[model samples]
Target: MYETLASVDWARLQFAVTALYHFLFVPLTLGLSFIVAIMETLYVRSGDEKWKRITRFWMTLFAINFAIGVATGIIMEFEFGTNWSNYSWFVGDIFGAPLAVEGILAFFMESTFFAVMFFGWDKVGKGFHLLSTWLVAVGSNLSALWILVANGWMQYPTGMAFNPDLFRYEMASFWDVVLSPVAVAKFLHTTGAGYVTSALFVMGISAWFLLKKRDVVLAKRSMVVAASFGLIVSLYVVLSGDESAHQVAQKQPAKLAAMEGIYEGEKRAGIVGFGLLRPDKQIGDKTSPFYLDITIPYALSLLGYHDINAFVPGIDDLVYGNAEKGIRPAQERLDSGKIAVGALADYKAARKSGDAATATAALDTFNAHVGDFGYGYLEKPEQIIPPVTPLFYSFHMMAGLGFWFLLLFTVTLYLLMVNDITRHTLWLRAALLSWPLGFVASELGWVVAEVGRQPWAVQDMLPVHIAMTDISGSSVMITVFAFAAIFTLLLIAEVRIMLKQIKIGIEGGH
Candidate 1:
């Protein structure tokens, strides 16, 4: 069992698993807290004891989730030094800046208010408490936004200077990192996903109450709120997904290729919601293991290029053809061309005097790779490239989850509309329980999105490989295992607590 497992990059493996567990709680925490806040506000305004009870019930669950999320999330920062040291060093100046701000600004605000909102319910005035809750909500979202800004920089780097002296990339403009296209799109997409998570969570608990014939009024109201939010957020997610896909196609075409399993340029590419990708050894095999592929050619055309007939490159076309000719070689050639004759002469002279033999080998290797006579060439900066395997799978996983979530939401919502949400106790229960799926989907979406662009803290600019330090794999493996074990226990405890809270809420325990 462990033999094949050893082949896995234990460090990366641990990080992904740990993060996934942490994220299960995050979206719900972000979106549900706001919904909960709204419920409490309604209670405050209307003086309805039911809404207050509902808020308290949800608050119990939120507290459980928040604790576990924080517990699992904190270790990740440390892992940057222990496991991803290289990546940290390479893009630290640029990457660290946003994360620091997130900690100092957003994280601090959220954490501070969160404690008060949880414990200060009676101690603080109703108005003050409500204000704190909303601030906490805003702080949570703000935290997400700023962190995503840093992440967006990774996906599409902007406003950075290449300092030869530092031998690494640094942020020249903080504003650019904050407002990158990647950041903006991800923010929309992620926030929308969070709303879905919250909706599903409320729906599940409300369904449970109906099943037990308990608190009919509370259950009905919860379902109404959940269904409404779900409706809006699901729509937003669909639109955001489209916009994000277009951006990915434009900025990270290879990722798009992998997501669609397209191997060549096609005027009309099929949009697939579910299908098996049998990576044919051949360039493009006639045989496919496709379970289902729904194609809407005009839609793809309209979305991608505002025309159905416009050609979109397939995976094969992208990876084998365009990637080399269109992206890689062209950039490399341009970069190679940028080396000045004077610079080359100066380097050679310095090398000759310093250590002629070693210098000659180094120069020869670099010149061969660079392709020019190593002089009089003007090269644009190298495009930041992600590690191949992680980037490939993560991008596809994110896309897969997006399509799956859409289908899940659509079917569940349909059932709710047709069958009367509270009446269909079993379906409602399923919907209520589906909260984890929604949460996981959002989390995985983020993971794939952020990790897929690895090696580049910034697109076409900073590289992750250079950021790492010369650390032992064993050290990383040890910490990864330790965290994995600890996080696993915490996750189990969180689930148990959440389930208990839901059971109590549905039973009108409050």
Candidate 2:
């Protein structure tokens, strides 16, 4: 047996693996680029040799990460066409447009300027090079915007129509897609995360330098910058993340429920503590049952409703909500019905006064009943479908890491600023050693977000089963293994290079 089940599962695993790996580099690139720009600007303004040195050191790491990010991201895009051909075809009109915009507006802009910023040290003027660097940062973030705009549309589809003639969804209005609430929130949340990611990365490396007693002035300066950025981003992450969660509550209740591990309606759902996310209703005591109870009774309510003790829907409600007798009964059919009725009313008023094409299209929609919503309406219990253990733990782990980073970074930054950064060498050494943890948290955060939305690759709109192409499991497996090997080697090489570079400082030679 070629493992038929593996084909479907394999694609998901590969996607999760690759996306997680790629994400590890993305935030660092985004954050590092901006910080590098800032460092370069400081250099340009003051003509300081130290700023130049700082920029060069950081740029080396940024370049390595950027290369890996681009390489891995290319694979994801290719996988869309190859592995997710059906998803591409079905939502191509609606989904493809944003991706196209990303390609044209974000990717090209970033890549073009990035080359200039990176390679044109001698060719471009100092100011022009700095401008190029900033543009690269802008372009990178813009890339995120378009991609999120598309993702936001997916999160909450807006201003789109199902064209029966084309057998796909089409954009009704560009502006509708742009102003989507989910996209807007996610863009802010993701951008903040990028800044935080880079800040923590810088903090970690700088801490290492301090621990080594290598360069006090430079290390302290880097710490100040990183900490300041980290503080702003951390606070913003919590605030914006809350807003994003509310958006999820409105748009994707099922996912929100999954995050909270709430399988049934609760008047006062607690903020979940680390424990078993058993949706089977079989873990602890049946009544008032949660594995390790330390929940804020009205936290979920507050998050979703700005009120205490609000009724939050569980997985059951979401499942029933999508059922045949439930809500969300093929939006296309509903639209078609409304259009047909309106057309009939118009025809009755004045058959000769109207354009025949409008009535004809309405009649076609009503008569043809063209929209085919596969099995998305059917929702099953978590008990029925076993959760991926990796995804389950990954989500919790990411959440855990986020809280940890927020807590530790806050305390340490406060301590460092109040007392001298060098005075608390233990903390600095700890922070230096722990720099990788921030990136780890980020990687895990992405893993949780992407993997938790599993079984349905394109959120709730399209199932992964139907979306995947006719690719063999063996082929996907080969690439999966190949990526693992290549990425591992690259990671080692990157760390080694960064370590060596860190040793070299303001006076120049180590």
Candidate 3:
């Protein structure tokens, strides 16, 4: 059991490392693609040579990031087959559908025009080049749309039914999976965050140019576009984030509870604005949950349910039943799940022995408790509760950074339009330093989303231990180190190349 658990942990670590590393490039690719396209569109419309130079310079950096992003991304898909074969077998029918479309349609569309957009500057007509650039932008986002759709389905597990004979989940409604509200909200929120990251990257680099007193016109123009774009998408991020919180509260109450560090259910629950969780606090303990805290009254209730007085279940309320609130205990679900697992084994055996009557009875029993099937694998009810400290801090930090981005964009835009932004050395340095925060904030948002839904690969249906392939712990550990080393090299190469291009300035493009 220890060896098996170690192997599972190692596999999880490997995937997490690869995913987090790959994501470093994904948001930049998503945001920069559109930003570059917009720059080109300006050049096409105004027939300005300076716009063309700006477009090409940014496009060069975008290309370098895109290449590295694609390389890292392909490995993540393959890891599904290598490290998580069981999960693939269980949900392949449902999960593979969108991935297939993403690769065949969205990926191919992006890759095909990517060449035209990057290399066809002189060979293609101005109109055709502009069209290709927009297509690349559309294709990149469309790719993200399909991928997020697949992930959102895991979070909510909609439009799928288990096939007892096949021992897997099958898609019931393609459109239901495609048009899931969770998917829509996740796509919007994730892409909006990516846009904000790209805007920060551009604005920060432009700030560096202003500080250095080089390419003043190009720097100012880029800042104007980035600030305007960042401000709009930042607002969109807030709206989409709210919808995502509501979805989590409805579908995964434990995660919502963890995010807010709530251990007791209440009406009009307050949100912790900033707090240090008490290290000694435990479930059902008399100790206060926080050492120091500031909370906004009724904010959590309003945010989670769109009702200021709605009851929000905490970790305690979820794990051990809340009878008055009509919430079932984790213990009950675990019992039901165990019965379901046993019935499934009996059903398979009976079918093999040609006992149709017994098989039918077993199948009925299995179906009755299949809703909590994944819980059967859990040894304790506490497994349902995710790491509260990490989730709490990550959620708050991500939110705090979001507000900062909004302020940065607003102030930067205001200063540039009215006062000469170049004259403000302090603000320029702040903007330049603030670029990496966008990446930090994007990573934190993901940590909150992924870590807060711990122990389950597919919420309430498939546990992570069951999803992993039967592999040795030492083997997985070696690969974990290997991937870390390789990814680090890739990141270094990207940064070095990008810095070289940035050093060359806008005139280098001409």
Candidate 4:
């Protein structure tokens, strides 16, 4: 059992490393594509060679980031087959559909247009070149949309039915999966973060140029575009985040509880504005969860349910049951899930033995408790609660950084347009330093989303251990170290290349 767990842990670590590394580039790619398109559009409208120079300068950076992002993304996809074959087999019918569309349609379109956008500036007509750039941007976002749709389906597991005979989930409604509310909210919120990331990247670089007193006019214009774009999308991020929280409350209450460090169920739950979780806190303990905290009154209830007085269940409520809240205990689900598991085995056995009536009865029993099937694999009810400390910190950090980005964009924009932004040396320095925070916030948002839904590969349906491929622990461990080294080198290379380009300055632009 320990060996099995070790193997699973290694596999998880490997995937996490790849995923986090890959994501470091994804958000920037998503946002920078559109920003470059917008810049080129400006160049076309006014026939301004300065706008063209700005477009080309940023586009060079975007192209470098895009190439590395594609490489990492493709490697991450191959890991699904290599490390998570069981999960792939179990939900491939439902999950693979969106990925296929992303690869075949979105990725193809993006790749094709990206060439024309990058190389067609002088060779092609200005209008056609601008169209290609816009197409590339649209294609990049469409790729994200499809990928998020698949991920959101994992979180919610909607529009699918379990096939007992096949021992897998099959897609029941394509449109339902595509247009799922969870999918929509996740895509919008995630892309909004991406937009803000690119804006910060642009503003930060621009600020650096200003501080160095090189290309003052270009720096100011870039700052204005980035600040305006960042400020608007920052609002979208917040609004979409609220909807995401509400969805979590409705669909995955355990994750919501873990995020807030809630151990006892309550009405009118207050959100922790900033809190340090007590190291010794445990489920059903009498001790307070936090060491020191400030909480806004009823904010959690409002955010979770769009109501100020909604009852928010905690980790204890989810694991031990809250009869008053009509929440069933994990133990009950575990028992039911075991029964379902037994029924499935019995059904398969009876079918093999050519006993039709027995198989029918077993199938009926399995269907009755299929909702708790994943719980059957768990050793204890406590497993339902995710890592509270990580979720709590990740959620707060993401939220705090988000608000800061909004403020930075607002203040930066105000200063740029109305006042002389270049005069504010302190603010320029702050802007330059704050760009990395966008990447940090983006990563934390993913940590909150992915880590918050622990244990389950597909929420409520497939646990992570059960979903792992049957591979040796040493094999996974070796790959983990290997990938870590490779990804680190790739990151260093991209950074060095980008810095070299930035050092060369906009004078290098065509």
Please give the CA lDDT of all the candidate structures. Answer: 0.66, 0.70, 0.92, 0.92
lDDT of 3: 0.92
| Lowest-sum lDDT 10-residue window in model 4 | 67-76
Q: How close is candidate 1 to the true structure, as a TM-score?
A: 0.81
1 versus 4: better lDDT goes to: 4
Scanning candidate 2 in windows of ten residues, the lowest lDDT window is: 377-386
Using lDDT as the measure, name the better of candidate 2 and candidate 3: 3
Per-residue alpha-carbon lDDT of candidate 1 for residues 101-185, written as tens digits (9 for 90 to 100): 7787655798888888888877988898888888887888887787778777777767775433344557898888888777899
Per-residue lDDT of model 3, residues 129-190, tens digit only: 99999999889999889999999998889899999999999999999999998898899999
Q: Model 2, 430-476: lDDT tens per residue?
A: 67666677777777666555555555555544557767887799888
- Stretches of candidate 1 off by over 4 Å are 1-8, 282-292, 320-420, 454-458, 462-466, 506-510
The residue ranges of model 2 lying beyond 4 angstroms of the native Cα positions read 1-4, 119-124, 278-289, 320-396, 505-510
**Predicted candidate 4 versus true structure: per-residue lDDT over 1-510, tens digit per residue:** 445688999998998899899999999999999899898999999999899999999999998898776768777788899888999999999999999998876657988888898878789999999999999988989989999999999999889999988999999999999999889999999999999999999999999999999988987888888999999999999999999999999999999999988899899999999999999998888689998999999999999998999999989889999888899999999999999999999999999999999999999999999999999999999998889989999999999999999999999999988858889999999999999999999999999889988989999899999999888899999999999999999899999999999998986754
Question: With candidate 3 superimposed using the best TM-score fit, by how many Å does residue 467's alpha carbon deviate from the native?
Answer: 0.9
Model 3: lowest-lDDT 10 consecutive positions: 1-10
